[model samples]
Each structure stands twice: as structure tokens, then as C-alpha cells.
Target: MTYSSDYLRSLVREDRVHRKMYVDPEIFELEKEKIFKKVWMYVGHESLVPDPGDYYCTTLVGQEVVLSRSPDGNINVIFNRCGHRGARVLNRKRGNAKVFTCMYHGWGFKPDGTLAGVPMKADFPGGVLEERASGMVALPRVKSYRGFVFASFNADVEPLEEYLGEARRGIDELTDRSPVGKIEFAFGCHRYHFDGNWKLQLENQADMYHPAACHASTVGPDGRQFQRRAGKEGGDAAFFTANGEAVVAQTGVRGFLKGHSSEASLFDKEQSGGVWDEYRAMMVDAYGEERTRDILKNRRHSMTLFPSVDILIAQTSVRVIRAVAVDRTEIEIWPVRLVGAPDVISTDLVKYVNITHSASSFIQSDDLEAFERCQEGLKTEGAEWFLVAKGLGDEVDEGKGVLFGPRSSEVGQRAQHVAWRDLMGA
Candidate 1:
């Protein structure tokens, strides 16, 4: 298989993606440039930086940036490099400070990327530093759609809202479902590192077909993909904890054109119709029966931010893929808190998801082994390409977009690859 960008693009035929897209280092670099760095990448939530001077540092795509509160109490994101020595100013993943000072040369910068202080004022040429030339490297642009913060390295990209397309509907569905029109993640984040490509996780999230095969608890020997075993970890039964459930019942999983897919099966009313007695009554009373039903009974979906931003369309939490190499990937998980939900509800949100899916989950341990083994096998001469031909000709392309089968098909992967081809000029 000659690995050309055009060839890679041609391999995505509605429901299938060629294996080389995941294995090619050159293609991975191209994606980092054309998709991840070029587009608006999610940073953190507004709650993370509530007060002026409060800040959280994180990577956008692969570029180091900070989500911080400006002097006027506005949340903004800026690159974390010092303008003088280029040393990392905000080294911690998150912190609170009036300004970030470079330890190397005593260069100081405000959250808005403005130069604040300079050591030994009378040192260089005119003995005065120019504000525009000496300030920290601010992002080309920083914007947020609701609470989700995003930044772009390139200056020519479209507005974040425009880039979101119909995906904005996913955010609306997620927020409107919450009683107060906003939601947050609990238990922090559940981080994961995959030996396989990070795209595998994106495809697996809404790829209903893989759950029965790739996930243990939900995967059945036949095609049921439900956990019936009480003994040893069954199929891909990666639970949030030992002897726990792994199924995340979002409202409904749906696929968007260009590799964006989501699931909202966890909407309680739709799953159980707000029928949990007092707790259900409380939710209904707070949000109203009809509103609660809309919140809980509807299928809320998670979305792929085109390339690597997997914004689980239904929750305040998100996973950003920080790809290190073609065969190695680091994922950062960030959960937000709902503005008005009960503590217990948010606690449960983190309990199972963090326990089962994060790096710490024993359930995830088995998944790691499998993905690592798959990586090892793919490197060998055994198979030239991995098969993504599931539900090939049977895709239900609605002219606008195709809906995948049971959240288990490779349609999402194909969608992403096709989008990738278009973006990279493959």
C-alpha cells in the first residue's frame, strides 16, 4: 500500500477507513497541522477560572496554552511561553496567580498576555521594552461557545461557532437538558493513554459495533453486547471500577458529517422516564416535568471536534487527545460541574466514568492490554491493514449525513477520515 495523502483520503468510502491513516507518522504530523493546530481546540471550562487572576494551564491541540481570568474577570486563553527567554511561564497544569513570571529571566506577564514586570528595568538598548514586541505570545484568537473555551494557532480559521456547524446543536442539547441550561463534570477527569491511535477511542465512543467487541461488560459472545457475567471480566467489560457497570446511557448516539458522532443514552427520563421516586420527583419539580423529560428522556450525544476534540455532546466533561507519536497518545480528561445539579448526581458522574474509563480503572487495564497488543500486532507482517469495513454498503446516508448502526459501526471513523482528507488536501 503506497502511503500517499491522496491515497489515504481515497480509502474512506462512506463506512470504511484504511489502516495506514493510523499507522503513518507523516499522516499523523499532517493531521496535527491541518486539523488540530489549524482549528479551534478546546481548553477548559469557565468554572476553572472564576475569579480575576485565577488560571488553569493546559495544552490546545499540542500547543501549550493557559485558561485564565483577565483583570476584568473575563476568561481568556493565551499561549504560555515567555516573550523574552521562551521558558514555560505557567508550568503547572493549573494554578492561580496575578501574573505568570518566567523563572529564568524574571519576565512577568498578565493573564491576557500583556507584559507586566521586567527585572532590572535599565538593562538593554533603550532601557525600555516595547509592549507589543515584548509581551507574551497571545493566541491568534480565543473564544468560547457557552462554557467550553477554545483557541487557535492559525489566524485564518473560521469562527469557532461557524466551525462547529450543526455540532452546535449538540451543545444546545447538552446544556438545555440541564435544568439551568448548563452542566459541569464531577470527579475531575479520567485520563487515558492508548497504545493504539487516539482516533480509535473517538471511533469507539459512538461506534456501537465496537462496544460488543472492544468493550468487555457490554460485549456478548453473540451480538447482544450486554454484561451477563458475574465472574471474571468478560469480553471488553471495562468497568469504571471492579465489579461495576461500564455502560454510559447517553440519550442517543448520532453521527454528523465529517467524523463527528455523539451519544445521549444517559438521559434518565428517556431511559427510565424520571421514575426514581423522590429523586425523580425532585428533578422534575426543579426542572418541571416536561423540561425534566426533555433533559433526561432525550438522547444527548457527544461530538468529535472534527479531529481530536471529543466533546461528549451530553456532558460538561471532555477528552482532548494530545498525540505524542503515531503509536503513542496521551489523553487529557476534564469534567465540568453542572451549574445547578445536586452533589450526588455530579458525584455519580465521576464515580463510574472516572473509575471505569480512566487510567486508574481496572476495567481500563484490560483495554490497555488489548490495545497495546493490537499495536504490537499491527507492527508485524501479519496484516497489511486493519479492517474497518463493518456496515459498509448498508450505511443509512440521509443525503445530509449517515446514521450509524447501534453505535457499533465504523461509520464514524470513515466520517472523520473523509473530513481529514478534505482538510489536509489529501
Candidate 2:
């Protein structure tokens, strides 16, 4: 069934959205064409291809693409299809390859996606294999900000930095945590899928209301969770212990334009001694005492860069969301290493990611169950809308496309649908 623009706009209201937004397969296909293809979707980081010949294979909106560094030291994102017969060129996930050759036909491409060689050149006419037609097609627009790369199919899309707007501050908070203002994805990643709509994961990232209930099993009677294996206090325990309703009220949620949003930090409790103190001293040395205090004091727990990526600052990780179908979604959780910080800090970040996001971990497992349940419940024919009215009118518009409210507010979810309605309507 084809949905009209007016109909799509009507599906999203100020306080709720139609259930068809989540359960309809047609709407999912429309989303891929309208939102994902038109916006600046994330495509790995520059660190993934540090060397000239290094390349990493990834997907955007279910289309396979390659992120490679050319000999001239420029990064390129090109379709993984072969220029000859359209077969997949690069099979491996990542490698240092000067040329990517197609197995089906003896055609090769340079790292920059230019046609390198063909099995028989003289067989075709001059116009048959022109320069433009002989090479893999690159996405229309590609840009990098602070080492994070984004690509868009629409040539007329807005500049990446401008699209990010105030959300860039959330990214700054993550990178600024490092003493040298740099971070890397050296710790690999945890990739898994959940049986639910892609928006479920995105909404849950900024949801402060569900953790206390969804993840209650992790917290014990003592109000502590995931005690450090090093026989020490603080760390993840500090975050889990403060999951009560009263404590959550202290934190807040901030929504930005283009569907970006962030959750205020819940683990900024002061650290007095041990490795944390040493880490603080390192930060103080790099950035003076005043700057370091500001950095550590106002950390953002998580930030969702609409439709694709989530930056979990407290865990030092990045979660990439991929929609497989109307009901199935895959997620990749990449742990980040803070540059120029104590080795223990990086190690602890990885450990936290493993404990919180790994497939076997209780936190992610619980959330996945909730997502699946939501998916199942939405399939019933009884309800036609999903209410997102919590803290609706209470949001304070702080000028410049920013709306914020209590930590448990559903304002962030509403902002997502607002962007969705506008895009789909367009």
C-alpha cells in the first residue's frame, strides 16, 4: 500500500504516534528511501583505515559499501559492487589491500575506487568502458568531523557539521575525556541482533525511565550492581546504585534538531583515590585543573545521532544500529580507547562494555527482551497508537532547536518522530 505524504504526517502527533510506524513493512521500506538515504549516516571512523591501503567493509541502510584509504591518504566510501558484473569485490571484513579484485570477473579496483585493470580491454568499444562507467560508484557526499565519517546518497544534503549542530557537544564530551583529545576503536566490537524495530534501540538509549525496571535484576538489595572485579568500589556500581526514581530526577534529557538527543550523566560522583585519581591528575596535566574539572563533572551518559549511531560516553563505546527488516535489527557495539590516558582507564572501559553490552550480559539481555516484547505487543490489532506524552508540555525550549526536561521524559522520543514525520512527508 502506498502511503500519501499527508497520511504519513498524520501518523505522528504531538503526544503520540501510530502503531503502523513500527509494525508495517511498507513504512520500513519508505523509511529506508526517505530518511536513511537522505541524511548523513555514519560510516565507520578514520581510525578503521589509518594506512593508505587499509580498508574496512561496512553497510549503510542495508547496502554494502567499502571504507578505504587511497594512496594519496584520502578516505573513500564506494559501493562494494564490482565495475564488471556487479559482484561483491571485497570479501574480507578488513585488510591492507592496494587493489580489490573481483572473483567473478578479472576486474580490479584501486583503494580509491578507480578502475585499475580489466581482463580484456580491447574486447569492448571506447565508449563501452568509459572512465565514469568503469569504476565503482561512490556515495554523493561524504565528510568527516572529529575522525567520525558520515556519508549521504543525496548530493544536496546539508553539511555534516551543520547537521550535527548542538549534538556535536556530546561528541566533544566523549573525545575530551581523553587527555590528548583523541580516541580509537582498537578494542574490536560486540555485534548482535534483536527481534524488534530499529527505533526501539534508539529510543531506549536515551530512556532513563526503563533502566530501573528493565535492569532491576542487576541491582541487588544493597543497591549496588556489577561490582568491580578488582575488589574496589566506584565505577559501574556507582551508576547502577543511582537508578532509583528520586536519583534519576536529578539527571535530565536534552533533545536536539535532526533527531539527536542525549542523557545526562548519572555516574559523575567524585573520585578521591586510586587509579581514578591518577587519571584525574593526567587530565589536569594536559588540560589545567579548572578545565579538567569541567570535563569530568559534566559527562553525558549517552548520545544518539539519529537513525544510525549512539555514543555511550560513560562506557566509552559506540553503538551502530542497522535495520535488517521491519521486525529485525542488528547492532554493533564498538569499545573506544581514550588516547594518552592511563592503560587501566582504557582497560576498564573495555571491561565495562563487555559487562553491559556483550550478548551474554544481563543489561543488554534484559533490554532485548523488552524490545522483543514491545514488538510482539505492537502486532496485536487492538491498539493503533503509542503514547509518548510523558513530560510532553514540561519540556523547556532553550532556544536554538534544543528542548530538555526531566531524565524520564519522553521528549526525546517525540523529537525523533517529529523528524521522522517531516522527512517522510517530504
Candidate 3:
């Protein structure tokens, strides 16, 4: 069924949204064109392809794309399709190749995505080879903010920094945590898929209301007992052992324009002792005492960069959302390493990601169950709309397109739909 712009806008009301937004395949196709292609989407980080000739193949907006580092020390995002036979040029997930040779026809492309040579010179048209028109197509816009690469299919889209807006604070918080002010997507990643719309995962990142209930088993008394049995007392386990109500009460949610939002830290700064003290000293040695205090105190548990990316600040990982179908989504969690920090810090981060986001993890599995249930429940014909009225009228308008609300509020989810309507309607 074709939906008009007016109808698309009507699907998202102030306090409720039509269920079709989550279950309609046509709407998902429309989202690919109107929302995903028109915005700056996270592709991959520069660290993924640091050296010249290094390349990493990944998906963006349901299309195969590659990030390649050129000899000029610049990274380029190019379509992975062969210019000759339309076959995928790069099959490997990552490698160091000066030229990508198509498996089908042996057509070669430089790291910068310029046509280099064709297998048979007389077989191709003269102009196609001479004009470099047959080269793999490079994305129109590719930019990186502090090593985090983003690409847009729309050439006329807003600048990356302006697009990030207040969301830059989240990135800053992650990078500043490193004494050298640099972070890398090291320690590999954990990739998983769920039978649910991409928005469900996006909204859950900033959601504080569901933790007390949805994650009760993980953070409740029973889970604490299990942790105690496993001899886990401090660190991240402390966050799980804390009273659910007390944690929710102390946390706050902040929403920004264009569907960007962040959840305040779930736990306070670690008490100064043992490795914690050593870490604090390292930070103090790098940044002065005042700046170090500010950096350590202003903690954000997670930050959702509209459309596809969630920065798990405290866990030192990034979750990238990829929409596979209207009711199916793929998520990739990449653990980050704080450069110049102690090896133990990075090691602990990887361990935390394994316990919380791995396919067999309890926390992530519970959330996936909820997401699947939401997908199934939305299929019922009995309900036409999904209510998102929690904290609807109580959101404080923190000027400059930011909304401040209680941790349990749906302000972030509402803001996302507002941006969705705007993009889909346009």
C-alpha cells in the first residue's frame, strides 16, 4: 500500500503512533529512502582502516559499502559493487589491499575508488575506461568527527558536526575518558539480530522505565544472589546490585533535536581505592584536577545518535542498528578501547560487553524478548495506536531544542517519532 506524505505524518500523533509504523514493510522501504538515505548515518570508524590500503566492508542503509584508506591518508566510503558486472568487489570483511579486484571480471579500483585497470581493454567501451566512469562509486559525503566516520547518500545534507548538535557531548564524554583523549574500536564486536523493528532497540537505549520491570531478573534480588555466588561484588556488578528504584530515581534522561538523546549514568563515580585510585591518578596526570573531576563526574550511561547508533559510554562500546526488515533488525556492539589508559580498563570493558551484550548474555536476551513481544503485540488488530504518553506534559523545555525529563519518561521515544514523521513526511 502506498502512503501519501499527509498519511505518513498522520501516523505519528503527539501522544501516540499508529502501529503500522513498526509492522509495515512499505513503510520500512519508505524509511530507507526518506530517512536513512537523507541523514548522516554511522558507517565505520577511521580506526577500522587506519593504514593506507586497509579496507573494511560493511552495510549501510541496506546496501553493501566499504571504508578504504587511501595513500593520501584519507578514508573513502564506496559502494562495493563491481562497476562492470555489478558483483561485490570486496568479499572479505576486512583486509589490506591497494586495489580491489572484482572476482567476476577482474576490474580493479584504487583505494580512493578510481578505476585503475580492466581485465580486457578492447572489451569495454573507450569512454567508460578513459573517463573513469566505471569505477566503484564513492559516497557523495564522508566525514569523521574525532575518528568516528559518518557518510550520507544525500550530497546536500547538513554538515556532520551540525547534524550531531548537542549529541557531540556524548562523543566527548567517551573520548575524554581516555587520558590521551582518543578511543579506538578495538576488542572486536558482538553482532546479534532480533525479530523486531529497529526503533524498538533505539527507544530502549534511552528508556529507564523498563529496567525496573523488564530487567528485574538481572538487577533484582535473585540476580544479586547469583552474582554473590559467582564472587562478583564491586565494579559493574554493583550497578546490578543497587536498588532498582534508587537507581531510577537518581538517573535522568535528556533528549535532543533530531531524535538524539542520552541517559544519565546509572552508577556514581567509583570510590577512590585500588585500581580506581590508580585510574583517577592517571586522569589527573593527563588533565588537571578540576577538568578530571568534571570528566569523571559528568557520566552518561548511554547516548543514542538518531537513526542507527547508540554509544554505551559507561560500557565503552557502540551499538549500531541495522534495519533488515520491518519487523527484523541487526545490532552490532563494538567495544571501544581508551587509548593511553591502563590495559586493565580496556580488558574490563571487553568483559563487561561480553556479559551484557553477547548473544548468550542475560541482560541483552531479556531486552530482545521484550522487543519481540512488542513486535508480536503490535500485530493485533485490536489496537491501532501504541501509546507514548508517559511524561508527555511534564517534559521541561531546556532551551536549544533539548528536553529534560524523569528517567522513566517516554520523552526520548516521542522525540524520535517526531523526527521520524518529519523525515518521512518530507
Q: List per-candidate RMSD values in Å.
A: 5.8, 2.1, 2.7
Q: Write the per-residue lDDT of candidate 1 for residues 1-426, one digit (tens) a residue.
A: 335556656755554455666777877777787777787777777777778888787776567788889889777777788888778888887778887889998889888888899888776779357765687777887888877777888898888877787776766765664557776643467666778876665666665443323555543344333321111222122223233333442123455765576654432222322222344466677878877766554354466666667765433457777777788887776655555655555554455456545686534565666667766766677545566656555556555564644424455566666677787663
lDDT of 2 at 389: 84
Q: Judged by lDDT, which candidate is best?
A: 2
lDDT of 2 by residue, 1-426 (tens): 899999999999998899999999999999999999999999998889999989999999999999999999898999999877789989999999778888888788888788888888888877887554678778899898888999999999999989999888877888898999998898889999999999999989768788777877887666666743221434644434344453454577888899998888766445446677888888999999999988876456788999899988767789999999999999999988888987887887778888888888878889999999999999998869889888888889988899997758888888888899999999
Q: Candidate 1, after superposition: displacement of residue 320 in Å?
A: 2.6
List residue ranges in candidate 2 displaced over 4 A.
227-234, 237-246
Number of the top-ranking candidate, with TM-score as the measure: 2
Candidate 3 lDDT by residue in tens digits, 9-128 = 999999999999999999999999999999999998888998999999999988999999999999899999877778999999999988889988788999988888876788766666
Each model's TM-score?
0.82, 0.95, 0.94
Please report how far candidate 3 places residue 250 from its true position, in Å: 4.8
Q: Candidate 3 has which clashing residue pairs, if any?
A: none
Give the per-residue Cα lDDT of candidate 2 at 410: 84
Indicate the worst ten consecutive residues by lDDT in candidate 1.
Answer: 227-236
lDDT of 2: 0.85
Better of 1 and 2 by lDDT: 2
Whose TM-score is higher: candidate 1's or candidate 3's? 3
